[model samples]
Target: MENSFLNRIKGKEFIFSTLLVAFVTVIGSFFRGIIDASNFAVLFLLAVVLSALWWGMASSVFTAFFGVLAFDFFLVPPYNSFSVSDLKYIYTFVGFIITGVIVSMVASRARRQAIETKQREARTAVLYRFSNEMAECETTPQVIGAVRKNVGELLGCSTAVFMPHKDGISDAGSDADFPLDTHEYAVAQWAFSNKKPAGSGTTTLSAAKAFYVPLETSLEAVGVLGIRTADGRVIFNTSEMELVTALANQSSVAIQRAVLTEKSREMELAKKTQALQAALLNSISHDLRTPLVSITGALSALSQDFEAVDAADRKELLQTAYDDSLHLNEIVGNILDMTRVESGNLKLNVRPCDLRDLIGASLTQLKDKLEGRMVAVDIPGDLLEVPVDFSLMMRVFINLIDNAAKYSPAGSEIYIGAKTEGNMAVMTVKDSGFGIPSGDLEHIFDKFFRAVKPRQVSGTGLGLSICRGIVEAHGGKIWARNNTESGAVFFIRLPLGDAGHGGRD
Candidate 1:
């Protein structure tokens, strides 16, 4: 607002400088007898000085020229005439003109210096703001956005950042407002290659539509920043060009930092992937070998001493071989299920199946494992049939029951309950066993995760993880929680309607 008021005052001084000189001439005429021509000359000089202070060199010089004409026409001895009776008066006129011109020149130079200082301060402030915005950028695209926004606001022009890639320069999906044509691209390429500015308002390729500045860092040039006004011409003063170059340099540093950060993240991910593969290979080899060894040893003993062993001893050895074979089959099955789930190939054969029948089948399958456990079933008789993949869901119940039996003490009551809640069928398998650690509850369903408790229990830790995958693929949710009194409870919620949302092929 203050600048506008000063501009208005300067405009008035330029437009009315002649009027001021004329006013001084009238005063001189009024006091022609009282005031000598020498005193009148001082009054005209004061008018010229005022013009130089307010309106700059052009207006001040204009005032000085007209003041000379006014003095000769209205105040000189030969009033309103150019003819001078004495040639000595010509020296006085010459001296007056020189003095007026010198005063105007001095004042005009001072005013120009002040204006330049103010403009430099304003440009510095703008550069500070652009620097602050660049500091918050964390990626190449984000840096490009900040550049476009700041440069456009600074110069009232469209802007873009062209980055080098395998195929020369590309915008890298940044939707820049400034479009680069063939000529403009050539100009931008020259700027980037030479690490200098080109195109409009510059010495090189001055006829191009846009101006291009190289985004150079201490290391090397990263890209080119292109600028174009709406009229297809770029123009800037010294301060503005300096500001553009400063922004480009800051952005180049930021882009380099972002690129390095991305590469660091990728390296970290590669290290993690290597570690996970090693862990997987180790776990599979150990689990696969243990059950195979047990089954081989049991069968080898039975084959060598079938007649020598008593009837009861033969039955015990046969049972041991059967159990180990089942264990071996389970390990292979869990591994296959995990592979299918991880590869996104787990398709569901959805069908409406009764909760009681599913639970009964799972219990029957695990009859040997749950031999010493007391099973308590509390499902409502008229409970609605849940839409699910029958085999996948039966496996879910089997895993839950087997896990409970393995963890709990002998003869402990394992409760299985089911009921309808809203549009869902909620089933829970709970056991009176050592509850999961508070920290491990959230990670229990993760692949290869085993609890710290019950280290003696034997099996690969893929059962619960597979169960979770299968349940979720059937459009259901599964979770485990510690009971208020003791032990842990596993809950499964499945949609009771059509299986449209399930992972069906």
Candidate 2:
């Protein structure tokens, strides 16, 4: 009842407490035959204690002062008269009031301490929870998400997190929809750059809607955290400020960890790319030089020994030069096609195209190469039509079939077949040669990944890679695997039913 009364009192609950003390004294006086009037000081002391606990020193002072008047008028010296015969009663009355004041002071001090301690404990709990969440985060986005969630729960406000990027500060968690106008962003940027707090309550650009704190670590500031309302005003208490600063410190470490991890990955990738580029350059140089040297030798034989050489020898030299030139042209064409695929410039013209036509065209182009090899075709009649780029798809099949023929022995059987599986048209090419290494299966489609091991192959290593690129561009997948008995099998799967709109993008 006292606690509820205190809540409803606002500022004047102490009056009722003092009045109760007076009323209790009067009741004690009514029972003066059984109780001593001097004992009513205990009632005055109770009122003072109640006032101090609920209303602090202000109400306690009023209760102490008024309590003495009630005691002196009703219970002191000459009983119901405003006259004192004994002057010593003044000293006694003064002592009683002083005692009440002392008790009031002590109780008020304890009450204030209790309130402050409870508030501090609440803030500490919030801080601990926020830190725990940030510690559990394994990535930058997770850290940002933790901050938004924890801060909103603690302060009951909207939150935003911005990380420094090459373009500028951008939303990290993507839930930061607070009032961050140009001025606010500038303030946040300043806070991030200076590794300090700004906006709302700070000395720097106080007009900003959000309060920004830099997520700083020992190394540097990696990001900025901000809290604000839609209308751009939130006043934080001292404890809140401390909690946010601690959270910022914890968040900085998490973000730093994420950033360093990403940087390490990028550096590793760059190193791999550098190594790949160097290998590609060396292989391309050797291939180009070998063909040029062969063509030059044949031309020299034709020009210098024209009168001495026979017609048959001259014809052989001419054919050799012409074949090398064609090989060079094919290498250049594969490189160009790979560039187009990598740059996303290969636009496809999608329509109902016959797959058999593509297989026929590719076989016609490589008829001389597959002169002695047995070619088997097993395409289902129902799988005749598919959406594809006619020329690009022809290149895809040509590369796979030619790749199979080049690797296998003379007169080796090459199987080419297609069938419908689910909503996709699946094609396969099997070569009866030595199967690929298990370790190299995954890298078979990478550029410059040559399959020949002990023997020297006569073509660039980009043919398979280019084939993969073209098939992927047409919204298909191409993969190679070792066959069960011997050689390797390549599968190409393309979605049917107007799938991918013929790779328009």
Candidate 3:
């Protein structure tokens, strides 16, 4: 847009300069009889100065040369010929041309400075907008995308950015967009390695098809930016090359910022993972020791006093040993199941199964825990069978029921319900216990995350996390929320149609 406007103005200047010279010649002719030839030469000089000031170098020089010709033919003593009547007129013509040339040079220099100033302002505005856009970019891909968009628009060329990784530079899968053969890639790598521009416009590797510029900052080079014009023409004039260099510098900073952000996130994740491992170790050691101690004590007592202990007391001790061993077994099983889920090694045996049977098995297993609680089941009799891995889904119910029994107070009611809605089977387990804290609701299913407020209960906090993993693996989802009245409700929603159809590994 700016270029077209300047071109139109230049064209008008050409026409106006020609007309002004011609108008001066007509006035000189009308007064030739009265005015001296020297006076007419002065008038032509005035026209030359005005042309130089107003219409710039080309127009001023054109008017100077043409006006001198008209003066000799119309106002000089020899009115119709290039031949000078006197030797003095030759000096005047030569003087006129030299003065006009000098003035035109000065005027053109000033015009060049003005045009460059305007272009600099334009480049600054473009760079400022690009910097702002890049500042908002938080990821490496986003920064690259912004680079492609801005560079493509600014230069009207195809652009590609290659970032360094541990293995090597990543092309970002831009082959179809900006294809580079072995030689072109070598040129790009050289630019990056040497921290210099290469390829078409640069002195280095000038024969290459695309211009390769290193995206460099004060610290280091982050990547290489490649630009290829469609016609394979060299288009990087002095000002444009400067603009591109400024853009590359800005992009380098943004890319470095994004890379640092990604590294920071990885560091944070590693810190969190270390913390989780420590928690797992502590929970496993405590859980494993408690049951082992109980079993050992019970067995030692029974073994030492088999004859001396009374029959009823003997039976009680034996039962304690058995129950503690079962508890120990459950702890080990939970750890193994969690490992399977985490490692993506848990394979499903998909089959059609009734929800009632699964709930029955879960309740029977938890009968000892729910001894005093009033349990209610509300599964509809006509509910259809669900496709799932029977064993994994059964474990889901057992964990939910057992978790409810642990959290809820004895004698409080626990409700288990299931129903189908729009091809999805929704099951819920509600417990009349102290509800989950609002702040902890979201993190409840995170591995090893126990409720902060309720500290009375103790177990490895892996059951709900395992449940979520299993449910999701079976094309389902699970979530928990507190009821308005009292306690908390856990909901599991599974797709009834073709869930676990492929038997996931």
Candidate 4:
């Protein structure tokens, strides 16, 4: 609405400029009765200045021609016809047009500068916004998101960001662009590998459907930024092309920041890994030895004297040996789970299974751990069967429930529940334990991730990672977060046999 109003005002100004010049020329014609015909050119020259100042060069030209014709017809000898009686008067028209043209050219120069000034301001604004957006990005995907959004806005075109990979660019799909085909993607690959631009607007590979530019820092070409205009133009104007280059440069710097952040994270992770390795060595010497020593000592005591000990003592010793051996077996089971996940060697024995049966079987196995804890089970009465590896799924539930029992205070309630969400069977395990630390929430399911600070907890941190591996193998999702009231909630969502969302397909 405001734009139309401003345009209307400009239209009126141009019209008034034309009319004002015409009025001045008419007035000059009457005054020529007293003034010299050449002197009348001065009055029309004023009209030319007015028109040029308010409108375009073409309007000024019109004004100049109108003035000369009026002067020749009204003020020159034989004052009514275009056929001038005196040929010397023709010089007046020539001088008049020359003055008008000179003024018009001057006005055009000013207008050009004004337009350039506006464009510069606009470009500055775009750069400022681009910097601010890029500054907030902390990850590679976030940087790509910023580039996608900003490029779409600034360039008014389709855009895609392709990160570097072993073979070529990695295409994380974007809705903002129609994906390039094999030939076009090859152009992008060339741009990235060569650390130069290719495709539509560039000198190289002009036949490509989209323009591809390498997002390069001084260290390396991190990725490629590709764009295609909506107007089907094979090229951009000078300023536009410069803007795209600047965007690529800015994105390069942002991606460089992300790269630096990742390196810093890796360094920190390496440090943690060293500490964990030391911890693992300690655990091997302690955790593995303690149970083995118990089993060995009990067996030795029983074998050493047949009649020296009572039958009750013999039975107790055998039980202790059996229990320690079970403990050792649990530790070995965790090790095997880690091996299976890392080596991708887990083969599932999948079948349609009931959640209630799985939960019951898991709880039966965890009776020792849950002996002192208050347990709540809320499996929905009509829960659907899920396609799963039954034994692995049972282990997942056992680990989760055991983790809950281990972390929570003795006698605190552990809640295990299941319901339906969309086409998924949603199960949750909640414990009244100290919640996961905020920084460590995302890393909980990572293998060997202990809490930031050491704890009195006795087990290796492989339980949740095993659960993650098993659930993912079944095409399910698993995540944990602190509950609002207290403790933490671990959620498992698995598809109900291709009902929707993710499944075997």
Over 1-505, each residue of candidate 2 has an lDDT whose tens digit, in order, gives: 2243345575565656666667767776876646655677777778788878977776877887787777777777567776766776576667777887888889989998897798778877777777777778877787788878877767677888889889578767634467757887888899888888999888888888788888888887888988885455455656667777777787788788878877898899999989988987898888888888889999998899698999999999999999999888988888788788777888888776777778989999999999988999987654367888899888899999988987887898999998877888899999998878999999889888876564646777788888888888878899989888899999999877764223333
Q: Which candidate is the best by lDDT?
A: 3
RMSD of each: 6.2, 5.9, 5.2, 7.5
Clashing pairs in 1: none
| TM of each candidate vs. truth | 0.72, 0.76, 0.81, 0.66
Query: Model 1, 278-370: lDDT tens per residue?
Result: 988898999988877877887788889888888898888788888878888889988998898777888888887877888999999999878
- How accurate locally is residue 127 in candidate 3, as Cα lDDT from 0 to 100? 98
Top candidate by TM-score = 3
* Model 2 residue 480 distance off true place after TM-score fit, in angstroms: 2.1
List, residue by residue over 1-505, the lDDT tens digit for candidate 3. 2343446688787788779888998988888878668677778877877887777777889888988888888778888888888888888889988987887888767877887788999999999999999999999999999988898899888888888767456674343557578888889889989999999977899999899899988998899999987667665777778889999999999999999999999999999989888988998999899988888987898889789988998889888889878888888989999999999989989787777787888888788888888999998766457888888998899998888878877789999999887878899999988889999999999998888435656567888999999999989999999999888999999888854222232
Model 3: lDDT to the true structure: 0.85
Lowest summed lDDT window (length 10), candidate 3: 496-505
In TM-score terms, candidate 4 sits at: 0.66
- Please report how far candidate 4 places residue 128 from its true position, in Å: 1.8
lDDT of each: 0.82, 0.80, 0.85, 0.82
Whole-model lDDT, model 1: 0.82
